[model samples]
Target: MITLQLAWRNLWRHRRRTWLTASAIAFATTLLVFMITLQLGAYDMMIDTSLRVFTGQLQVQRQGYHAKPQMRATVPDAQALAARLRAASGLDGVAARAQGFALASSVSRSYGVPVIGVEPEFEARVSTLPHLIKQGRYLSSDQAQEAVLGAALARNLKLQIGDELTLLGSGKDGSIAATIVPVVGIFESGNPELDRHLVQLPLKTFQEVFTMGDDAHAIVVSGPSHEAIPQTQATVAAQLAPGSGLVVLDWEQLIPGLRQLIQADMVQNWITYIALILIVTLSIMNTFLMSVLERTREFGIMLALGSSPWRIGVIVLLESVYLTLLGLGIGLLLGGGIAVYLHYEGFTFPGMAEIYAQFGLPGVIHPKLSFAGFTLGPAVIFVFTVLAALYPALRIRKLQPVEAIHAV
Candidate 1:
């Protein structure tokens, strides 16, 4: 208790220096927490948006389909497979999709487009397509000879709801597949590529038009939450029919670009964090070194009065601990408050919607709060501050009582 009181008094004797050192640590801690929280939140948004746009969190597809998706590379009896997976645990939604390339034509214009066949009821539950409809209603299972056009596709072809569109493509067996269908809806996906060249039709219509029968390119699945995907995927993989060539892939594998983007961002962020911590470490060490030099005579007096070198070293460490704790408290309060506010209110960048449209990303970002973001910064500062105090402690141990007392 006496040693602690002495250490406490010694720290306050240099009030300005102590406060300055503590404030530096506090500032660094707050900055780290804020940046990490915001980055994590933005990543969450990106993952969800990318997954919901078209790719669900998990997909079951025929082998080699992801590498080279062709009409022939499809999951046979996909509706049966979907039914089996739907009965499994940890699954939130499941839908089958068939996709192909085709030329679309109207009375005035023609363009190449990617065509998608979907089950309206299940597709509505698994993807964002239903909610993204800008005009007209979504497709119904009974609605044959009707199609949906992306906003950009609609504009380029100069077609409107109730207009007829002609499609021409090759079927699964290299047969000529052609059809004329009425446009019933138009959707804006906020993705330039998707909006410009994507079309959707009823699964039954697509199978008949493309000669796909009941086969699908993929069976998309979604988990209740992001964290549940791995377990859900594992369970689904294990339960597949023994001779089935189907393979399960998570979003990280399906959309390698998204994973790569997050990894690259994280690497840059960690580099920045290391640099900030290094600067703060130097500042802390300087404070402790100056304090040791100024208190040389006092330490010498204690040694003369029979205080052990180990005891003096302990005092220096205690001072560091006190400063670190104080700084961490202040920093956590400020950073956490700001994170909560940003999490709820969100932030928008000017003209970001158009810019992000090119990359298929959303413009607004909301920062998320997590235990790692809140604790990592203060923990790093605490450990580094104690290490910085070690130099001063070693200097005290090496001090000669007679010379230190006789000097200044």
Candidate 2:
């Protein structure tokens, strides 16, 4: 208790210097928390948007379908697999879809586009397409020879609600056939590639047109939560027959490009965080060394009065702990205040917004807070402080009392 009091007093003896060091640590902590929160939040948003817009938590496809996605490479037991996946625990919904490239044309214009055939109710349970309709209405479950066009595709073809468009493509026998489909709706996803290429129609319509009844290119499954994806995938995989010749892929594997991008960002953030910690550590070490040099005579006097080297070391460590704790407290308050403000208002980058919009990313970014941010920031600061004090404490043990006392 006595040693603690002495240490506390020593920390406050030079209030300005101690406060400066503490403020530096606090500022570092605040920046780290804010930056990391923003990075993680952006990553989370990207994954969520991608999942909602296209891929679900997991997908099951024929063994070689992913490598060469074509109308012919569809799962033969798609209906049975979808039923098994839908029945699995931790799964929210499962839907089967067939995808292919086709030429869509009006009398005035013609363009090649990607077509997706889906079961309306099952698709609504798994994806956000139902909510993304911008004009007219989504395709009804009973609607036959109906199609939905993306905004860009509609504009290019000069199409509107109730317009009849001719879709020409090769059927299962590789013979070219054409069907007239009434456009039911137009959707805009803010993704140029998707918006310009995608068109949706009823699964039955596709089956009749492509001559592939009860077959699908893939079965998309949504889990109750992201954390449950792996477990749900396992359950669904186990339900499949031994020779079904299907492969189940998780979101990360299905979207390797997006996963790689997130990983790269995380790596960059870690490097920046390490650099900041090193800078702060160096600054604190220099300050502690200077303090020990200035207080040599005082330390010698205390030693002469029966203060042990161990007590001197404890005092230095205690001083570091006190400053670190104070800094951490201030840092958490400041960082929390900023994060709360940003979480509500969001941050917008003007010119960058358009660039990101082209890639289907939102203009505004929200900050996120987690238990790790609240706890780990202070813990790291405290560890850095203790480490910085080690050299100065060792210097105190090497001092001879008489020489140290008389030198200055």
**Local distance difference test scores for all models:** 0.85, 0.81
Residue ranges of candidate 1 with Cα displaced over 4 Å: 1-9, 90-92, 107-109, 269-279, 301-318, 340-366, 390-403
Per-residue lDDT tens digits of candidate 2, residues 103-123? 999879999887888888788
Model 2 residue pairs with clashes: none
* TM-score (all chains, Cα) for each model: 0.85, 0.80
Which numbered prediction scores highest in TM-score against the true structure? 1
Model 2 weakest 10-residue run by lDDT? 83-92
For model 2, the superposed segments whose C-alpha errors exceed 4 Å read 1-9, 90-92, 173-177, 267-279, 299-318, 333-371, 379-387, 390-403
Error of 2 at 216 (Å): 0.6
